[model samples]
Target: MIELQGVHKAFGPKRVLNGIDLTVPTGESMVIIGGSGTGKSVLIKCILGLIRHDAGQILLDGEDVTKAERDAFLARFGMLFQGGALFDSLTVWQNVAFRLLRGSLKRPKDEAREIAIEKLRRVGLKPDVADLFPAELSGGMQKRVGLARAIAAEPEIIFFDEPTTGLDPIMSGVINDLIREIVVEMGATAMTITHDMTSVRAIADKVAMLHDGVIQWTGPVSQLDESGDPYLDQFIHGRAEGPIEAVR
Candidate 1:
């Protein structure tokens, strides 16, 4: 459960998020769509407190968590980064179980390894792959490992950052299906940010389009095609000639 009200942020003279207001229900899957440099990622950072908002209210589960004890609050979340961002030194299992193996939450090594392998299987990875390092796997395999890592702690909320990016069409489809399954099977509240249309169709129950630093459209995924916002139309159809301005 998350809510943002009139959130505003800027970098020097360039305003990023003008006034972002959005919400995600306790167990809902909400995906945000937008072109690059539209402040989609910045919105996410604000929600997570990775970036400070100038003045606004961000409520997590009806509580004001914007300035709360951050780590205690953030422990409730898991995130799959766009680049996979795995450590080169740690094996796949360690990467998945990183938080579990260190600090006060540390579990027995054997127990952590077992949970890591189980999560890997849930993401359609073979058991033996757990022993390999990130560089040893292909890009698709790396993404699967990243998903496994994201869900390893079984956090109540999961944020997926471009889960289907940089892969071939088939691999992207595979990752999309895995994300959908995780959201449904775990009943985890999901917030995904991506530009991939296929990822939108597969992983989103509700869609919100971010443009010019605000949510221009938010609707059920089924109605996305017929929303009639020229910007949304241009984005989902991948058209070069519509209401969206080209980078020329």
Candidate 2:
């Protein structure tokens, strides 16, 4: 459902992405794994048009995203940001229903709240929790709230940025399972960028390792362990040395 061809992006003197070529098929979950500063998030932003690429093309469902209508094009996707990014001023339900309460997808307040509650339940949150604010929740709860919000609009595509970051092992496992379940249940195409290997194992149908600003390896998750690529092997095993240099 998404494709990037010869994509390149640079900021001033630094080159972040260099000719990235990758694809995510319809209803498939593709997880991108990479070292720090390898531009995983930048790749997603490029596709979303948040950071315009300097060259090449990004196509969504066969049409170039750069030429598409901004609002209408964006409505087809959802994002769960790295930090949860819930509104501090809004209640949990309000945060989840934010998109539904405004713009082309707007619904009546009561309707939006009901949908939010249902989404919360799907993410293993109780309706009672919906009335609480973000500050009152635990990290896991906040992540769930973010997940609920991402799926609230029933988007055809979803982007998960470091979904398991900053959570304990058990909580990370919960979030991984939740992400996998929701993506499959919704039958949506998913692209996730995360350094968490466990999250990649649990959530990805296919895995792509980004290095040196380009894809070094792309294959099914099952093949990751046996792929025999130095860069990928170093990353998945957390090796201190290989083709990838560990920063001191």
Candidate 3:
């Protein structure tokens, strides 16, 4: 459903993505693992056209993403940001129904609220929580709210950025399981960028390791342990030694 070929991106003297090539088949989950500053977020931005690549091609279902109409293109995607990124001023249902309340996906306010409540339930939150502000919710609740919002629009593609960041192990596991289940049930193509190996193990059908601005290794999750690539080895095992140099 998505493909990148020889993609390149840089800011002044620093090059973040260099010759990146990846393919995400339709209705499958692809998780990208990499060290901090390795261009994982940049790669996603390039694909979404939030950041334009310097060279090469980004294709979404065989159509060039750069040339596509912005609103129409973005409407097909849903994203759960690294930070919960909820609107502090909006009530839970308002935040979840945000996209549905405006733009091309707009629905009647009452209908949007109903969909938001349903999505919230799907993410394990109850209806009573909908009228509360984000500040009233705990971190786990906030993250669940974000997940509800991501799937509320029923997007064809979903991107998860560090889905488990800041959650306790138990909550992280819950989110991982929820993400896997939602992707499967919705039949949405997913691309996630995260440092959490536990999330990778739970949510990925395929895994790609990004290093030095390129994909160093990519294969089925079942083969992850035996991939034998030094970069993948060091990153996955959290080894301080190996090909990756730990910053002091």
lDDT of 2 at 13: 82
Residue 43 accuracy (lDDT) in model 2: 96
Q: In candidate 1, residue 28 scores what lDDT?
A: 92
Pairs with backbone N, CA or C atoms under 3 Å apart (clashes), candidate 2:
none
Q: Write the per-residue lDDT of candidate 3 for residues 106-159, one digit (tens) a residue.
A: 999999999999999999999999999999999999999999999999999999
Off by over 4 Å in 3: none
Instruction: Please give the ranking of all candidate structures by TM-score, highest first, separated by commas.
Output: 2, 3, 1
Model 3 residue 173 lDDT score = 99
Query: Model 1 compared with the native: what TM-score?
Result: 0.97
- lDDT over C-alpha atoms for residue 193 of model 2: 95
| Cα RMSD to the true fold for all candidates | 1.1, 0.7, 0.8
Off by over 4 Å in 2: none
lDDT accuracy of residue 17 in candidate 3: 91
TM-score of each: 0.97, 0.99, 0.98
lDDT of 3 at 14: 100
